[model samples]
Target: MDHIIEAIASALNISVKQIKNTLGLLEEGNTVPFIARYRKEVTGGLDEEQIRVIQENYAYQVNLEKRKEDVLRLIEQQGKLTDEIKADVMKAEKLSQVEDIYRPYQQKRKTRATDAIAKGLKPLAEWILTLPRTADIEAEAKKYINDKVETMEDALQGAKDIIAEMASDDAQVRSRIRNSMEKYGHLVTKAKKKHTDEKKVYKMYYEYSERVSSLANHRIMAIDRGEKEKVLNVSIDFDEEYIINWTINKFTKKRTSPVNYLIDEAVKDGLKRLAFPSVEREIRNELSEKAHEASIEVFSMNLERLLLQPPMKNKMVLGFDPAFRTGCKLAVIDHTGKMIDVSVIYPHQPNAKVKESQRIMLDLLKKYPIDIIAIGNGTASRESEAFVAKLIKDYNLNVSYTIVSEAGASVYSASKLAREEFPDLHVEQRSAISIARRIQDPLSELIKIDPQSIGVGQYQHDLPQARLKERLDFVVSKAVNRVGVNVNMASAELLKNISGLNASCAKNIVAYREEHGEIHNRKELKKVPKIGAKAFEQAAGFLRIEDGDEMLDRTSIHPESYDLAKKILKELDIKEEEMGSASAADKVKEASVKKLCETLEADSYTVKDILDSIAAPLRDYRDQYAQPMLRSDVLELSDLHIGQQLEGVVRNVVDFGAFVDIGLHEDGLVHISKMSKQRVSHPSELVAVGDIVKVWVYNIDEEKQKVQLSFLQP
Candidate 1:
């Protein structure tokens, strides 16, 4: 455990004391945000993401420690414990290594060894391992040669098979074989060319293969997909003599035994029949797990970024679910996002006139004066974008429209949340409304939808579900806490994600609000049942009050931290009651921030922490993504040539290249060479997930909708 803790501390470059303090705060019911923001004295001001990594790695280390103890116990029970073996067991860092060391001792069903022993071939096998010049192999084999062992040939054959099995099962052999394969195995994929006539799904992958050791995460995923489709037959194979020679050379250099020749033959046989198969399975499984981890990690990060996108500030929004067959489902929401009305417009219906749908939208536009239009990017979305784009231009409507990434709009529409929100409305209406609502408040709206359906992941569904859920949930929870919520207005769903606020507590808050009215002051919160000292300490500072009757009510200062805020203002000789207004606000807050840190006996980062906690700006939410760049003109699809110039946002950065969104349906890939003026090991060195810059469109495949953009100027 100490070793693991030291490893984590080394990786993060933080003190063990800080790690311990952070863990204690986490265990005592404070959230990453709470600790980072208010309890910075304890955590040394580690952000939520850093804290999550710490928490996850800390848990892994604890589990590894338990596994180490268990392995040690198992080896002792098997009478194989030695100082060297104990040292190896203690040094096993990963689960796989620990399991590998314990593998030989693990109980298994009867194999060739058991069958050979059953046939009385154990004595002959022992003789081979202790070969003496006086003993003849054939003479020793004759005694055990019978029906059970068959002929003298069967006796020797059985002995050979048992020896091979024993050699393969040896921990040292398995470890050597596993390591060699990881370094050298090539994943050879061949077509069941004859099975081509069967017309299975993997036809595309049948023609290609590569080294398993070097396969990239995305490529391995694609190959796995191809295999699943039955279009490819893939096999991972490697040269066994290479691995056998390496292992035998490393292990046998210590001894010059009388049975060395027999042992060599036995090892050769073991490499072919036993070691190769076991190692192949182990390597493939390891590669798959590595690929899964990479995919899940990227998915988890993207999900968090997408979920935390800034919400459209208090405004009534009209969401349009565009579809050709059913026309468009329109949902008009009030300032609080309550559905005011819903209707349908036959904008694309064959029998209907364009003018009729045009008039329908204009009427709603006038009625609502909607602050934003959320159009689902599915089905007739492009047409709808053109429709709305032209509508705003021709009529010069003040309402602006955003093309919402409505990946799970339909799924959420079909969910119970949709039913509860619009029970009387049709499924299409619910779906369209969800699309708009999601654009307005992505975190609140998307939480009702499964993250997988939101579609930013590489192989979300294929990932280990438990791992995937854990990762996605952590991201979501972190994002929710970072955004901070209006306890008075936030939905129960959103509130439930707050630190220390469970489903029951969230429901109680909502019910309490309903029974009374808008919570006028932070003090009013103390009256809520079960929201006692601990829960309040955990949740109060995170829940904001838009215009609470009390001035501190609107700030993120916890009720417990309030006295220090007053003391700071008093030190400056300012009255606390008058400090809430515009004239004294900044001075009082700055003083308060410093005073809070001083009170807590923390650092300058802690003072800045208190500032962000008290009043985070709207930019805090949207800053996670590439900032919006509204173009004055549109690039017509027909105007595009192979080489075009445009401005783009860095949607995603990776080791290979940067994906740039240039106001198009699909983002363009700018290979690493074209990324910057200098060399870099990763795309993130120059470009982040969201950075807007000029790009040159190098290629266009309209059929595939792949736009190639380069950051390099012409």
Candidate 2:
């Protein structure tokens, strides 16, 4: 435990006390958001991201410890566990290192080495390994010759096999080889003759070789996928002769030994036959694991940015799910995201009833006072967008339309949860509603579907599903809790992501709300089944109640802090009902956090958060980017020209670059090289998902429908 704590502290560059305190809070059932937001003093002001890192590292360290114990026990059972070996195992930092240390003592399958040992040639192998200068190797081998060995040559071969196994199993030897390979190896890949990719997705990698130390993570995943699909064969190449010599030096004490040639042969055999295959796998797996982690981090960041996109609040949105064979699905949602109407219009193919469809769309727009049109970016989207843009311009309609990613809307529409939510509506109607709600409040609507299906990240399906889900879920939970939910307005799905509330507790809250009407105060939350004191303690701060019994209930002030808040307000001569108003906010902002802490006998961190909360009651963390890019115009691939500047929303950020949506159904790629005149390591340095940026068209592949964009000015 102490070792784990110290290692975590060093890795995170945080103090041991902070790590210990944060771990303690986590063990005591406090959620990451709860610990970060409320236990600021306890964790020495660690933020949610830091807390999450600490938690993840803590779990890894615990697993490493368990593995260490297992390795020790297994090695002890073999009766080869010396104090030195035990110390080495104990000092091993990673699980891989532990396994490397344990490999020699581990049980093995039937092999030439085991067979040689069984033939009573173990003593000969040991004597040869000593590399005696004047040893008569053939005479020693002759003594071991028997029915199983057959002759002196056979005995020598058996001894060499045993020596090869011994060299391969040495933990130090394997570690050195792995490190050398990782530092100097080149990842070589070649396409198969019969398995050509017509789309040329993997064309660049068809004949490629890059240093293992220098390959980008995205390239690794790309190469991995190509290898997996059998389009390419990949291998790591390095200096095998150098590695063989290094292994030989471990056993050869005398350079002029008569048996040195035979020992060298055995070492060479070990390098080629046993060590390289196993070590290459270890190096590649390590590289792939690192790549997976880096990719997951990228995915998690993108998902976080995507989820936290500001809601288009107080707008009557018309969700238009475009299609060709079937009529386009349309659903009208009010300011609060309630579905008020549902209809379909056949504007695109088969029907071609443009006049009739135009009339229906215009009527719906006028009927609902629709503020925005959220067109789904899917099949027939461009056509639908063109139709909407022309409709707005031709008639000079007040509403504007933006292309909303409809990646998971259809999936959500067909889900069992959707069935339960909208039992009366068809799947298309549900989809329309989902698109509308997503624009209104992305986090709320997005939490309903599987996050992996949201399509915000690269290679999400290739990632370990459990780890990906866990990380994406954490992103959702943090986003939900960061922007406090209105208890009366939030769905069970959104509520389930609240800090201490699980699916059952969230359902109970909603069920209780349904039976008893709008929850009037935080106190009423305790009445919900399965929501006990601890749950309320962890959750109350993040659940808002507008026009509730107490004014602070609508703010992020937790229930337990009500007394301190009341005392502070009383001391400041501010009325409870006027807590969040402009005058009260000004007064609270003017008050000294340190002075208040001293007067109220509270932690300084808590006092600061309370003061900030009082200044901006029910403050939305998403207000930083409160508006998404709404377009009254649309573009086509043919309309694009080199150096034509356009404003776009960054859709997805990958290692190489970001994909920006410029009102076209297909987004353009802004490669890292063209992002700026200066060199950039990754696109994330300049853009994140949902960032609105100005990009110029650099080039176009009209036939392939690919647009290369640049963030640099013309």
Candidate 3:
């Protein structure tokens, strides 16, 4: 256990005490976001990312230890467990190393080496290695050429097979070969014979070769997907002769002896027949796992940014779900995201009822005091944008519209959760409401759907489903917890992500709220089923009661700290009613953290957190992030000219670059090279999913409806 803690500390570059404290907290059912936000002193101020890394690495180390125990016990049961082999297994840092040390002792099916041993030629195989330089190999072979072994050739071949297996099973030899392959290997891919490049999607990879070390994570995932689809054949190749010579040099002791040539032949045979294939597979798997982790990290970060998009609070929104055949679905949601009205307008092709659609839209605008229009960026969005633009101009409506990504709207609209939430509404109507609600509160609405369906990732479908889901779930948890949920208005889906809350507990909370009235205080939460003391301890800080009697209940201060918070507030002469007023801010700033800690009998960290919360009770962390671009006008692809500068919101960020929505039907691509004049390793370094960036048109392909943009402006 101590060694595992030490290993985690080394991997994360943190103190051993910090890791131990964090592990203790984690073992006690504390979540990563909980540990990060609430246990600052215990973890030495480690943030959520650092805590998650420690947690993940500790799990891996624990699994490695379990595997080591299993290997040791298996080898002991086989009666082949020497002290040296046991020490090697015990010292193994990774599962692969432990497996390598246990390879020879593992029980196996019949093979050439096993057949030779069964034929009574084991002594001859061992004797060949002990032979001197002048020893006659043929004389020894003849001695074993009795009953089962018909001839000298058969005896010698059997001995060679045994030698080959021995060389291939050596742990050190396999490790060296695997390391060399990783260092010097080139991964190459080619078009398969049966596949054609009609779409040219895999054309660049048809005859592509790149050093294994230099291949980017995105390219690796792309190649893996193409290979899985059978559009390309992929293989890793390296200097085989070098590997063979290295193997020989490591195992062969006597270079001038006649047996030396036999050992050399066995080494070459082993590499070609067994070791190379096995080692190549190991290296590729290792590289793929690394790529998978990196891709998941990028996806997690992007998802976090998208989930934390600042809400357009206190605004009545009109959600426009664009369509082609069916008319555009429209939903009017009030400031609190309650559906006030719903309608359908056909402003696009096949119907093209522009005047009629305009009349309906203008009437809805007059009926409801709509503050913003959120058009779904799908289907006939451009036509809808044009119609809205003309209506706003002719009617001189005092409102603006922003294009909202509707990637997962259809999926969410048809989901079981959506059905439960809006049982009476159609799928398109629910989608229209979702489009509007996402703009008002992205984290709440987006959490209702699967994170993978949110569509901010690269090759999300190709990723391991369990691992990807786990990672995305963590992202949602962090985002949801960061912005505390209002217990009154939050749906069960949003409440489920709160720390220490699950589907059952969240459902119970909603049920309790429905049976009674809105929960008005932290004490009332205990009455909800499954929310015992421990669960309340973990979740109370993240669940807010907006109009509650206790002001701290509305803020992020945990319930346990209520006494300390009250003491600090009393010491500062600040009233609970005026806790967030400017006068309270002045009192908090004027009070010394050291003096408050002394007065409250608490630590400085706790005092500072209390003071900060008092200054800005119920502060939304999403306010720190960039808000979506609310556009007063729209642009078209045809209206773009070369070098024309425009404002765009980064819709998605990938390894190669970013896709920006410049108020057009199709998003423009800002390639990585055009992201900056200075060298940047990734597009994320320059922009994130919600960043509003400035770019100029560099190239346009009208036939393909692709727009190439450059963030580097003149």
Candidate 4:
């Protein structure tokens, strides 16, 4: 445990005390969000990300230690364990390193070396290593002749095989070669001879070669996908001769030895036949793992940003899911996201009921007072947008429209949760509702769908599913807890994401609410099934009741600190009803945190948190982000010209650039090179998914309906 603590502290550059305390809390079954929010003093004020890193590092260290112990036990059972081997095992930081150390002693299948040993040629193989200066190696090999060895040549070949296998098993040799390959190797990919790529999706990779160390993670994922699809063949290209010669020199003791040629042959054979393939696999796996981690991090960050996009509060939105054959599903939702009306409009080809569609839309708009139309960016989206723009212009209606990414709307519509929410509605109708609701409250609606289906990631399907799911789940939980769920209005999906709550518990809470009535206070949560004392302790701070019995329940102040809160209120001469009022804020501003801590016998973190919560009870963290960009006008591909400046919301950020929805059918691309005059390591550093930025048209591919945008003026 001490070793794990020290290792995590050293790796993360955190204090040993912080790591130890955080680990203790985690071991006590405290969720990362709970500890980060409520136990700030115990963790030295570490944020959610930092606490999660400590948890991940601690788990990794524990797993590595267990592996080391297992490896040591296995080696000891074989009576091959030495002080040096034990030391090496103990010092190994990664599982791969430990495996490499244990590879030589691990039981093997029928191999050339094992066959030679079974045939009683082990002594000859050992003798050859001495590199006898004047000894005749062929004569020495004859001494080991047996039923398994027919001739002197056979004996010598067996001995050479054993020596080669031994050389391949040498951990030091494998490590050196692996390191050299990683530093100097190139990943070379080529088009498969028989494969046809009509789309040219992987054209750039047909004859591509890049240094392994310098390759971008997106490129690696792309190449991997291409190879998986059989469009490309990939291999690692390294200086094999240099490695072979280095291995030979490391093993050769005397240049003048008569058996030096045999040792040289064995070393070459061993490296080419055994070591190269094994090391190449290790290198590729390592590179793939790194690429997956980088991609997952990018995906997780993008997902978090998308989830936290500011809601279009208090707006009556019309969801427009556009399609040709199915017409377009339109759902009008009220300010609170309840579906008020549902209709279909065919404003495009085939039916092309332009007049009738406009009448239906006008009637709904007039009836519901729709403020904005959330157009789904799917088939016929631009056509639908044009229709909406023309209707608004023709009728002079007081409404606007914006394109929304409908990446996962279909998936969410068909989900069991969606069915439960809208059992009588069709899938498309449910999708329309989801679209409108997502625009109104993205965090609430988006949480209902799987994060991967949100389509904010790159090569999400190609990455390890379990790892991706784990990361995305954590990101969702972090975002949900950061925003604080409203106990009364939150769906089971949102409630499940709250700290210390699971699907079953969230469902139970909802059931309890349905069976009885609205939970008026935090104490009422105890009456809900599956919510125990520990669960309540971890979740209470993040669960808010907007108009509950206890005033502190309306704020983020934990119930455990209610007494202290009241004492502080009394000390400051503030009434319980004054929370979130201007007078309460003013008084909190004038109070000294240090003096309050001393007077109240409380920690500074607790006092400051309570005071801040009191000043602005139930603050929506999402309010800090920019609201979704609304547009009354629409643009066509033909309307775009170079150097035209336009404001667009960044739709998706990837490794190469950001896609900006410039009110066109196709989102414009702002490549990394054009993102800034200064170097940008990643697109996220410059812009996120929801940022509305001003960009100019650098170029336009009208044929492709693609617009190239740049941050700088052309």
Q: lDDT: which candidate is best? A: 4
Q: What TM-score would each prediction reach against the true structure?
A: 0.90, 0.97, 0.95, 0.97
- Which residue pairs overlap in candidate 4's backbone? none
Candidate 2, residues 1-714: lDDT per residue as tens digits? Answer: 898899999999999999999999999989999998899999999988999899889899999999999989988887878999989988888889999998888788999999999999999988887767687777888998778889999999998999999899999889888877788889999998889587888999888999999999999889888988889989888888877877888789537788888888888898789999999988888778788888988998998898898998899999999999889999999998888999999998788889999999989988888999998888999899999999999998888888888889989999999999899999999999998888899989998989889888777777888988888888898889999899998999999999989999999998998899999999989889999999999999999998888888888888888899888888888888776789988898689878888888899987877777777886889989737778787788888899999989998999989999997768899999999898898788889999999999999998779899999987
Tens-digit per-residue lDDT, 1-714, candidate 4: 897888788888889999989888998999999999899999999999999888888888889999999999999999999999999889888899999999999899999989888999888878878777799777787787777899998898888898898889888888888887889989999999999789999999999999999999899889888998999999889999888888888878536688888889899899989998999888888888999998898899999999999888899999999999789999999998888899998889888999999999999987888888999998999888888999888888899887888889999999999998999999999999988888899999999999989898888889899999999999999999998988998989899999989999899989988888889999999988899999999999889998879888888889999999999999888999888889999999999999999988899999999999888886789888888888877798888788999999998888999999998888999999998899999989989888999999999887787899999987
- After superposition, which runs of candidate 1 have C-alpha atoms over 4 Å from their true positions? 194-213, 246-265, 349-352, 572-606, 611-635, 648-667, 670-674, 677-693, 703-705
Arranged by lDDT, best first = 4, 2, 3, 1
Alpha-carbon shift of residue 472 in model 4 (angstroms): 1.0
What would the per-residue lDDT of candidate 1 be over residues 216-242, giving only the tens digit for each residue? 776777667666655567777667777
- CA lDDT of every candidate: 0.73, 0.89, 0.88, 0.90
Write down the lDDT that model 4 would get: 0.90
Query: Mind sharing the TM-score for model 3?
Result: 0.95
Models sorted by TM-score, best on top: 4, 2, 3, 1
